[model samples]
Target: MRKLVIAISMLAFAGSAAFADPILDRQALMKERGKIVGGLAKVAKGEDPFDAAAVLTQLQALQANAEKLDVDALFPAGSDAGDTTAGPKIWEDMAGFKATEDKYLADVKAATAAAPGDVDALKGQINTLGGDCGTCHQTYRVKKG
Candidate 1:
């Protein structure tokens, strides 16, 4: 399932006209993150549910795309992508933003070992990952845009 989602993410990024509604896209990404990370936690509980292998496999893939992903594309500079709700501080504060993402990937990599039977510990790590998501959203996304 994680692999399928990653494949979709990839296809969405690659397609030239794949412009998802900004607000809806943001919600979808946040929800998807919750589901995938939560799925890892369930595996840690020894529930034998959700394909942990797929999650593990896509962690690196997601991170790779994430590293290159410009959330600001939701608010492109010179192109005709139209006005986005993302703030200009995203570019002004890019270093911090990339660090946030790097730390997210790092956390996911460390937490991956908890898979198949380490859900509890992974759950703890999962919340920390949410911190990154929350921080960026708070800084970059407009609440009602």
Candidate 2:
């Protein structure tokens, strides 16, 4: 099931890449990331049944997602004009933005390596990952109602 999910995700990403609309592509990627995080959060908060394998699967998915991110291509020079929540800061400080993205990828990699076997451990991993997400969102994302 994990393999199937990964395969399907890969296919979807590949299919999406052909279109090459950075704004929409980036939005889709972030949405998938959010969904993955939300699933993990449900388990961490005891809202969903904790399955060690499922947790690992989600972590692996996050790792795969992070591994495939091409931030430069995703947020090109002219993409800021469209329907996006990406802040101007992303373009102004591209290096800083990439650094933050790198930190997020690192955090996700570490959590996946830790492979939290239970809910308590999963909560810690989720907290760390969530902090990384919040850090990027707070700095790089424009909040819109």
Candidate 3:
């Protein structure tokens, strides 16, 4: 029926509009980045066996995720509202925020190129990567309860 079609169209538009919010988009991307780091962390912590290929795969995925992050677009002016945990420093010091992002990407690319073959190597790589993540989070993220 025409009414059914209209209702379905409205629902689809509503769903898409919800996802179109930049806050939601950046949060989703950050969640995915966390998952990739978590996967690598398991191996680094020895909770998971170190498989060279698997570690490389995760590193590559991390690179892709970092590369996909467009901080300017994702964290545009006036997008600091809603459920976001972004710190005020991010907007106040946009240049510093972007520099951190660039550093993270560079570290990921270097680690990927290095391609750790053993647990020790992977641990070192993870440490550097984790440090980069921590620095950014400490400076640019707000803790929410």
Candidate 4:
């Protein structure tokens, strides 16, 4: 039983170490950010109207990229993911951190899907998505020097 527990713990640690490089995670995040923001900007401006085609394309790409960046793995619980500007508050306030990512993805997906049908309504949803971002930034992110 003890050996089994140790094996499982070791596997979990190895997985975290394999995936938890903040530099790479940050880079992955930046790519997703660019796609999601640019995608939604097209919607906010009402640039595409009924089509929303470009926004949809970018949004889909954003979602795909987002799936690769896990909020749970944002912290190096045991292994080092490097010195993140993320701060210890994120790890300590784990529920808050997870909720931010959860809402971001959900809001973006729902809003993007509806954009093609009702541009105005979708715009409102998009604003909510942006608001989620503001909330997360307020909690988790530090202002750039």
Using all chains and alpha carbons, the TM-scores for the candidates as numbered come to 0.54, 0.89, 0.86, 0.68
TM-score of structure candidate 4: 0.68
- Candidate 1 vs candidate 2: the lDDT winner is 2
C-alpha positional error of residue 109 in candidate 2 after TM-score superposition, expressed in Å: 0.9
- Candidate 3 has a TM-score of 0.86
Ranking by lDDT: 3, 2, 4, 1
Candidate 4: deviation at residue 123, Å?
2.2
RMSD of each: 6.1, 3.3, 7.0, 9.4
Candidate 1 residue pairs in clash (backbone atoms < 3 Å): 44-119
- After superposing all C-alphas onto the true structure, candidate 1 shows an RMSD in angstroms of 6.1
lDDT digits (tens) for residues 1-145 of candidate 2: 9999999999988867643888888888889899999999999999999999999999999988877678888888989997999999999999999998898899899988889888999999899889989989999999999
Q: What is the lDDT of residue 60 in candidate 4?
A: 74
Lowest-lDDT window of 10 residues in candidate 4?
76-85
Using lDDT as the measure, name the better of candidate 1 and candidate 3: 3
Candidate 1 lDDT, tens digit per residue, 1-145?
9999999989877566433555445445555666665555455465655465665664544454344444565434432234444555666777776677667767666655554334455456656666777787788655553
Using TM-score as the measure, the top candidate is 2
lDDT of 3 by residue, 1-145 (tens): 9999999999688656643678988898899999999999999899999999989999999998898788877899988888899998999999999999999999999999999989899889889989999999999999999
Model 4: per-residue Cα lDDT over 1-145, one tens digit each: 9999999999688556645565566655756686667666676776755455666676677666555567656455642234445656677788888878888888767755665455675577667867877887888766655
Clashes (N, CA, C under 3 Å) per candidate: 1, 0, 0, 0
